[model samples]
Target: MYNGEKRRSSYLMLFIKNRIGTVLIFSVMPLILVSGIILYQFKASHYEKIHAHLGTLVKKHKQNIDSFLNEKLGDIHFIAEIYSFHELGNETFLKEKLETLQQAYGPVFVDLGVVNSHGVQVAYAGPFKLGKAVYSDADWFKEAMKREYVISDVFLGLRGLPHFIVAVRKSVNGDQWVLRATIDFAAFNDLVENIRIGETGFAFILNKEGDFQTKPLMDVIPEKGPYMDLLESDTKEEVQIVEKEDELSGNNIYVSAFLKNGDWLLVYQQKASDAFSAFTKALRVSVIIIILGSIGTIALAFVRFKNMAHHMEKAEHERRLMNEQIIETGKLAVVGELAAGVAHEINNPVAIMVEEAGWIEDLLEEEEFKESENIAEFRRALKQINTQGKRCKEITQKLLSFARKTDSKIQEVQINELIEEIITLSAQRAKFSNVTIGCQLQDGLPVIQGAHTELQQVLLNLINNALDAMEKGGGTIDIKTRLNKDHIVVEIADNGPGIASANLKRIFEPFFTTKPVGKGTGLGLSICYGIMKRLGGDIEVQSVIDKGTIFRINIPLKKYIGEKQDLIM
Candidate 1:
């Protein structure tokens, strides 16, 4: 499209496309930009609030669970530090202490056990019948011996029931011993389970090894979730929120926080669609509105630009017509100047020739040969020269009169007098073309107020066009003037081949030509039409194909049109 080497592109289509693009850029850019910015801010604020709220909930739950475990461990350590190992080793005394603890803390302290340095439960109280149960090689005993205090992940221990321990180790007289207690699994499980949120939200705990420590609300695979990723990522954030697509469930949201001094994780899981449902709905509605608004903007720009282009084309056409009219006016002015010059130059020669012929006739009538034989012939020849020179003088006078008033000053005009001047101007061309120009004038016609040069030009153009049409063969151009009611009417009819019905309608339209190339500019009748209309008059035409054409001009009377008295010049 850039280069016109092989084939040319239609630049009009290019212009239209360019305009459409320009309009869309200016119009739609702001709409999309503002909408996108607003939506982005809304999404950011909404997501920040969600993450903050979930983090707060998870942190609170973590604190309560840690406090519960620490309190239980402190209780056991208090008993170990207060009474001697000998006192705790008595079965009856251990039973009494366990009863006191259960009375204070409810069933959260299920059972108490006293284990010796040799991994044997020296004393047991309540619940199971383990008065003589051995504690060697047990996992809790092994873990309890290593640390001063421990809260372990839930495990099915010797009783074949889900349970975990809060154990405290003490050294007395060079002997190491663990005072351990069993915490109720149902009571600890309630802490994690109660952290539910929306429809698909639930909280659970996982150890460092990706194994569940508390029962979850729904079935979960520990190996295949974003919580596992959060667990391994080792980020320092207190609460981590992640959204990921799941193979079977579409999208899921996971919020995680480290629990139990970074030994386990408290993770809350929910569907992402459920977490930010309000934002999603708002986004959908905004998108719909923007789409509809964009369509409307494009349609409006298209129509507006198309209208502007159409008006521009029409204005260009009118400008060309005006330019042509200016050229026609300049041509008429030059022709009038040339006509006046020729008339002045020819007038002197004809006057001199007429005087010289009279001088010769005077000499022939006088002199020494009053009875000479060639005197009659010479007198006849002198008479002939005198007649032709007088005719030439009259023609030049007519030309000077027509050329003198070529200005557009308003003055009173006699319609018959203008027609007579036009007939005299076109008389020679009519004779050469074998055409005759005839005029029918009625005297005492009322004067019309108009421009003299413009009226003369209109009549002269009609007569000359008639002469051209009949140039191929002889024809008659009849001119008539009359007072028709409240107006003055002039009719110029030609007995030449008339205009076709098709061309007759558009005879007064500018630049609409049916003539051969260079023979016509087609502005004659259009200028005439404009002139008549500007003078508060009208020009009309009627024609048959083979008969003749008649052009009529009507000028409104000044008195009838409520104007001042007509100025007679």
Candidate 2:
């Protein structure tokens, strides 16, 4: 049966270990898997969203440029209607009227001209000679002749300068004609060059043929290979692409969106490094917080576990010590009982010897024995025997004190007189060392009900300790008593190398002592603590190493004595 039980316990232990391992793995594995899935999804979704958002930004930018062009062209169209209807068949008059209208629209438009159906420059304004320039072959003029109105892509003009053209066909004097406007492309380039959505986002314009209308503001020329070919093929469709290339730093994804009217693509390209820089910084901080939180959780758990383990070990150690103390206390009880009985039994013999010694001394003093030389020696022996017997009795008395409960005898004791009495009694003892005892007891101290003998014993123990601590070079021991508030305070202080700073607080603990082996039972302060507590008083100590130690015993002056007489009767 014992073997079966052992096998069962072993199986249970193995099962617990397996369970712990399973729990640890299951707890962390799911988090790891979930985090991986979430991070993958987050990365994929973020990239798609960034691409979509970039495309949207470029599309809006293209719309804004288109709208601005249409508005500027509308002003020219209104002027064309005026020239076609009011100034028909008169080029010089039309030119003069167009200049006044152009001046009202401000200086942004450089020149306005009227071109006849034969592509002849009929009317001109703003620093260009009439009949010197014709635009029958210009793309805008050809498109406008077919489609009434069109805007030309940026190209070098007759002045060897880059510019864009707006053309609109109208009926003048019953003949179809084209009205043309020239705008400085450098100003347009400036407007396009500075266009940006965010810190690192850049914008540029491309024409219907996928040719650069304006140079891209980006540091690297946009990838113009397969990706650009695809974009150009789908000029009508707003599309975006993300491509990796060493030409652009970081993860370069160029976004392009087309304007429907001109097939012009407004492209913005962003490096992922700059685009997600803020998010990356935030992610780093979040990871640090999680790591710190996990570390703190583990550290706290470890500290709590260590504390609990220590408490359990401490309690077990105390239990063992308590059992040992109980066993020792039992032995001490037996010893005390034996001592008391032996003291009772030996009292008769001791009394007989003491009486016989008295008689012998009396006889030796008589003249009949005065001449005997050995009589003095006999008397000396008897005296020595009496002294030994008294010493034994004192030892037995102390031993018996441990066998019974100590009760305080309440009496109206004078504070100064008590201190004096204790000093006198202690001075007569051979065990007391050469410690200087002094008293600064206050005069006129109110008499209080307390155990006089027990209080004396408390003082005696403290003085003996001080003397022992002083050893050869005796130090001052001051006993003081005074009335404080509603209490009587008795303070005992010693100038001997004070209690070690570490031990001062535990001085009153039972069986705690600094005395050499066989010199103390270590019960003196413990008994003193119990006696003072029973007397409705408390003992407090303050000490600094190598300075001094002070003990303050406070007793309630107005102790409840029930219906007993106020005076010590």
Query: What are the lDDT scores of the predictions, listed in order?
Result: 0.79, 0.67
Task: Quote the RMSD, in angstroms, for model 1.
Answer: 13.4
Clashes of each: 0, 0
lDDT of 1 by residue, 246-357 (tens): 7866688888888778888999888887888878888898899889998898888777766776676568746865666456445544554565588689988888998999
Measured against the true structure, the TM-scores of the candidates, in listed sequence, are 0.54, 0.50
Model 1: lDDT to the true structure? 0.79
lDDT of 2 by residue, 1-569 (tens): 34534764565555455554554455545554665566667667776777677767666677777776787788778777765533633656766755775567555577777777778776676666645477778777788888877788888867777778877789756777877778767666766676675667776777755667777665544354333654556445666665655543656566766653636766666666666665566556656655675556545654554555557656765686466545644554454455546756787887788788788888788887888879768878988988977865665455444333455577887767877888787674414466777888888888777778877887888777777777766677888888899888988888877776446545655546788765775667766765565566767676656677888888777663444321111
Candidate 2 residue pairs in clash (backbone atoms < 3 Å) = none
Query: RMSD to native for every prediction?
Result: 13.4, 12.4
Question: In model 2, what is the error at residue 242, expressed in angstroms?
Answer: 15
